[model samples]
Target: MDLKNKILQTPTGKKLLSEYQLNLLTKNNIETLLDFHDAENQKLNKLLAIKLESVLEIKKELDMLPWQSETFVETVNELDFGTGIEELDKFLDSIAQPFRRGRVWEVCGQTGVGKTQLMYTLALNFVWKHKLQVLFIDTKQDFSTKRIQDMLLERKVDQETSEKAMADIHVVEVLTSEELIEVLKAFDQQMTDDVQAALKTKVVVVDSLAACFVDHRGREMRRTRDSLLTEVACRVRKLAVRGVAFVIGNISFSQDSGTF
Candidate 1:
């Protein structure tokens, strides 16, 4: 009901200012100023005219708001998404592992740097340890039965564990980012609506977030693609806010290593 809550409802970047910013606009009608700046493509004058009288009624110059605490630390500490892989217990302890629920996670890295391996490991934790349901959105069409078999084999766990892992894990293949987005939007709502759903979803891993978002959008600055990625970021933030764990993958290459 308050400004802070409303601001939190919007994406972070979109919330560019505290009350301090209110001082810079032409008038003191804060609502009019916000509507103007946040307007996607609307005309400023027409938008402002409605509040012109309200602005004129204001007498005092807007005082800058008190400096608020940086939410980064709070958000990160609260960002409980990835599962705690027991085998990687030492590694898990080293990282700031946040207890997660169902969310979109974008795990990124350079190629051959353990993106896929980490995801499989995390998936195992979700099912075997946490007793959570994980819907793996496989866009690459690269999931191999052998890989799953091998992971369980290397761990030397029994067939019961392997079968249960495979049975509990749900996989869906999407051809593109647009398709992935649509499916995610649909699946999330469906999962929420299902009654007494045996599913206890803790995370959503996109294995490699880059593959689904390969199309370049602009020639001038090559920033177009990242612009599109903002939508995904919004979803990630929303999910995290709702306590879902998300593990997204990335493959970055470095010439020094000669591969990624």
Candidate 2:
């Protein structure tokens, strides 16, 4: 494939460059963009690489991804995963109108901001009110059953309902990224007939996805982290397409980078 065409085939190059930027590179001839893309000249590759990087970064910053375009139906059938905070739930509804199913949600904040608490609330609501199954994946295996039970009691939910609600949630603890990847890969097949029959699983929660990477640092580790995240994103997208909601938890130490 020609350079421009090849770039277009990849997610990084799937967006159209601004006409002004293209004009700068091609002198108003769109074909010149292709020429620059396919050029064998050493100097041209260096120049093209710089320009391409800039354009790709621009695309990413703008969220103008090829897969993100509104070329297909944009309406989403949603399910309410209420955080149990009335005002917060209202705010979330205004933002996404019930947090559409099959999409991934990331909850993050500093240590005391109730990120895990909100997750617990969401899981309980999904189970008790919605009568749906929730798969809770914990990296630290510290998810509190007692807390959920307390919340249930506070809400005046009967003991039978509380027991059933707790029963509907499945828990898995993984200490490594490899184990997390393996579980995600086999997720579809693991949704057995019995699992499918009791309650159609509506949510999967990963409490603190960042926990798996807490031990790693440096460039190579960062690359591995990014790759694993990409794989997770792909798998999550597939699950979402099949109508499962994914809720992810992340931790942040600074105000600028923490909350989602």
Candidate 3:
């Protein structure tokens, strides 16, 4: 008998297997009834393995509950990491909605108008004040450790604290929009897994998001760029919902009328 006939012979298979599954089995080259049986067994085995792994993970978390309660003291308020500038902070606060966690803030301006400088300042402030980690995604390769260090010292932050703050500002350089998407996806996975690094990372700074797509000029390239940007935004929003703040720097350009 054919695979369909054999499958329909069993009440369970007839009820369980959908037309799509039958097509998928044929696509996978499961021609014989024996092949179909083996494929079904493999799928069952994989499902069982996944359930077993989930149970093990739950057990591990239960075992660590006591230790976690003692070690992981949630001291800092995740929503309150502010810009270091007092005037700016005051203005933001006066609006009744300061830059809080679980949100994406864009700093947009013309080139050489201190957009990157502002991003660096925000990253520094986040690390220095909150004692939390900042993920600096530098697309233009403009990240300067010396600049960060000088800013810290100018603030009269001591040697130990300065070094620690800089250490917490993790900088990752990616040249292309595709690369940025990959980094964001990986960071999203890290956050989803509740890894130690992700737990500590309260802010993610993308310095100059425009630089990643500057070379994408043609229509096809522009479409690809837009798709990548959409994906990046989705991933960043997902991370924000997990209580991480995002500060993205973007460049503004003037049209024929000369207004940005």
Q: Highest lDDT among the candidates is held by which one?
A: 3
lDDT of each: 0.53, 0.63, 0.69
Residue pairs with clashing backbones, model 3: none
Ranking 1 against 3 by lDDT, winner: 3
Question: What pairs collide in candidate 2?
Answer: 102-240
Residue 143 of candidate 2: its Cα lDDT?
82
| TM-score of every candidate | 0.62, 0.67, 0.68
Residue 248 in model 1: lDDT: 78
TM-score of 1: 0.62
- Writing each residue's lDDT as its tens digit, candidate 1 over 1-260 gives 33333333344312443444433333534343223223322132243332322222221011112212222212323434445654455565477444455344466676777789878878876787766667677878897667878877987888887898877677778766667666665654554565233236656767667677655423652443433454355445444444556777876656675321
Give model 3 RMSD, 1 decimal: 13.5
- For model 2, how big is the CA root-mean-square deviation? 9.0
* Global Cα lDDT for candidate 1: 0.53
Location of the lowest summed lDDT over 10 successive residues in candidate 2: 64-73
Point out where model 1 deviates above 4 Å: 2-88, 91-99, 102-106, 156-160, 195-199, 217-224, 255-260
Off by over 4 Å in 3: 1-78, 257-260
Residue-by-residue lDDT tens digits, candidate 2, 1-71: 33344345545445544334344444424243223422323343244444533443432332323333122
